[model samples]
Target: MRRPLRILQATALALCLLTTAAPASASAASSPAPSPPSAAEAGPVLAVPADLAAEEVSFRGGGGLAMRGTVLSPAKAPVEGGPGRPGIVLVHGSGAGVSRTKLREEAVAFARQGLSVLIYDKRSEGYSLFRRSYPQLADDALGAVAALRSRPGVDPAGVGIWGFSEGGWVAPIAASRSADIAFVVLVGANGMPPLRQQTWAVAAGLRKAGVSGSLVERAEPAMYRLIADGGLFPEPYHDPGPTLAAVRQPVLGVWGVHDLLTPPAENPPLVARALEKGGNRRYTFHFFPGADHAAHLSPDGGVTRLPELAPGYADLVGSWVRDVTAGRTPVAGTSGPAPVQDSATVPMGPAARWESAPVQLAALVLFAVAFAAYPLVALVRRLRGRSRRPVTRAARLLAATGAAAVLGLFCYLFYVLTTGAKLAAPGPVAAGRPLIWLALQVLAVTCVAATVLTASAWYRSRGSADPARPGERGERVRLGLLLAGGAVFVPWALYWGLLLP
Candidate 1:
């Protein structure tokens, strides 16, 4: 009973927060760009170098949507009939922006290394917060690849895909489907399912902000599962294992040591193992120090992402692309400083069908009706000039505090999601708990104690009640409803970690 109510509250909270983070836009096509952990977060824009030349172009994406982009190449163009330059198609991680310049830093960096780079606006036709098709996105990426291949200076045989974050997943799918995608590059990629990665990300973000206790250890995991089960988290259960295993292209994986979103230490080994499982031994892994998830400069671990790419990051990509395209595949090995991960990732499979989205929504509706009935009935009796039968003070406290705690928990979690846990400012911390969480826990205990007192009062008065007292039957009815609300409250509180120490 309590589990349903708890999941109900969590599902509601997560749905609202997720919608706010990745709101559905009128445009159907969207790019999965660097958001936080998986993708769909927006990134900062920087100027492309003036020395490089850019060409505006468009191509057909998945479902025949017109995808637009730019091709950046060296100043002295390669002659149309001459040997073409190696090329790369940059895949946006996840976001709504469709400008071709979204990946100016990468395009310019690789172009500077004599590789033509295509950066494009990901389609908006079939993408948003509530829905997306990765295979479709992969098709869109392949479209960009074809466009790059056709460009006068780009070598069709050497064309490849570079995925960052969300793009990491899409790139492999594209590579696996097409032998034309000669190579693959991934930055901040994850080996786990999207749901698991997201669950780990929020917890990691909270822990990085010095948070602990139930919010991180308990509520966060439960909340994410409820969210995914509700179908609000698109592609939450997407397994990248088979996709990576199918990729036969020469692969180069990079991670920033300070990356907070993806588990750097965990993912590389999983990726390497998966690729090796496919009998591909031409993969290389490297780690960059003092960088964030996007390989951007991060002075304070990965809490804040600065606009500038980490030193040697662009150069590494440029040089690696040059070598790999030229058949100089590096020996399969992992290099650079070991990646950092403070905690192991938690598993986040879908919730049981009993705890599915509709059931959770229905449970929430029931809780709302039960809790709201107490005060509404009292107010109506007062308005009708009906003298109310005396009820114990404990009953009133239970009603007030129970409602307040639920509402507060909902709002606080919303704040954490919308503004980010770090920006939500959980206030002072002591004993591994934040002040706000402590207050809610106190309220939860108060509600529980009041329920016991209220029940005791009702039990004592039951036999004393006359069968014909004017409002006795009504008073008993109201008390029963309040008690029922309390029954639901216990499990609800426990589920949200409010009842936990």
Candidate 2:
């Protein structure tokens, strides 16, 4: 009976496995093979000028990935016109998936301006049926240039590429490989070494969070290491400096003043420095005030979210393109002035000095409180023995101290937040002097509160005697010491470990 049952169970398991595997195998086997275009399908249908249409094109890119793109052209060249019109390519940033909508809009915008535009889905984005790698993306861009050149109304000699964010890097890398690219526009592009950029980003975030200077200083190394390792601890991603230096094209780098993710302060100077070193005077930079990373989606200062197009970005970009394509020098005032220094200048204001002092004082006070609070509570418990009191004075002291400590922490956080905001705001008065005063106040309040809370918690616990041994204090002194130690060290650890980079 047992043998038969075991055999039956084995048979059921085999059937289940076959059922699950059959569909996947059949699906793979039955998938259709791709077909190629016949000779008759080689050229686009030539409609009249009023009936111009867009067409989809597919080709193989680098690493054997099938790439797809859309090409828009004048249905019929004007009777008196030459063989082709100027061609342009639009490259997308890393966002909620690259789409043809942006490309279509760009193509129509350029087409309206009398230039043919070829906009394609990036590898693995939109309708393209392949995963993308950096090398593959570069190849796709090159392929786009080639596809546009082959179109009937596109002039191979007048080709250019416009890229945003990560696309900025892609455009130049692609342009370097193709001689047909006439020019390039890079929006929110960086020229800094990747490590420096990452460090700056971390520091800016910590500053915004109201972390103090001493803590920031101590934390800087750890933060840099985190960035250097590319969010991992062992290895880094791409190195920006070497990669950027390789491209030798005329570039217009655009950035926003209030961009927190990739601050202009970190990248603009790097670009300017690189240009000076290379003796390449062909680049230009434009910085917009009060704009974030996704500035293109928020042109009118209304919405401040990502992925939305900033107001006036398209117009600004369009103008830049026209000037570059027409061989006109960008007016110096339109693109912001060149960076003055290669590295960020550290400000030595009153805020910096005060921050250092308060942090040192806080650390010392915390240490004292941690060592003294317990002993003081124990002495009081011994003196008040056998009182039969409902609440012991020692326990009351501990509760009061805890409350005060909590209050002090809240006040300190508030002051830091307010001060940081003021410092980062546009029209900066002297924030350093005021910040110093604020830091001192925070230190004083926190010290007093920590002392009071340690005492209060100790007092309150002594009052809660055990039911069997009603008069005895239950090791309240030891617990108070532990709490005090935590209060002293946790904040310092957070500050020194994460904020300074």
Best by TM-score: 1
Q: In model 2, how large is the Cα lDDT of residue 19?
A: 25
lDDT of 1 by residue, 272-316 (tens): 989999988889888999988888889888878887888888888
The global C-alpha lDDT for each of the candidates, from Candidate 1 onward, is: 0.79, 0.51
| TM-score of each model, in listed order | 0.90, 0.52
Candidate 1, 37: how far from true, in Å? 34
RMSD of each: 5.6, 14.2
lDDT of 2 by residue, 247-298 (tens): 5656677776556556566666676666556555667677755455545443
Off by over 4 Å in 2: 1-53, 72-83, 95-97, 102-108, 124-133, 198-224, 227-237, 242-244, 288-501
Candidate 1 worst ten-residue window by lDDT: 33-42
- Strongest candidate by lDDT: 1
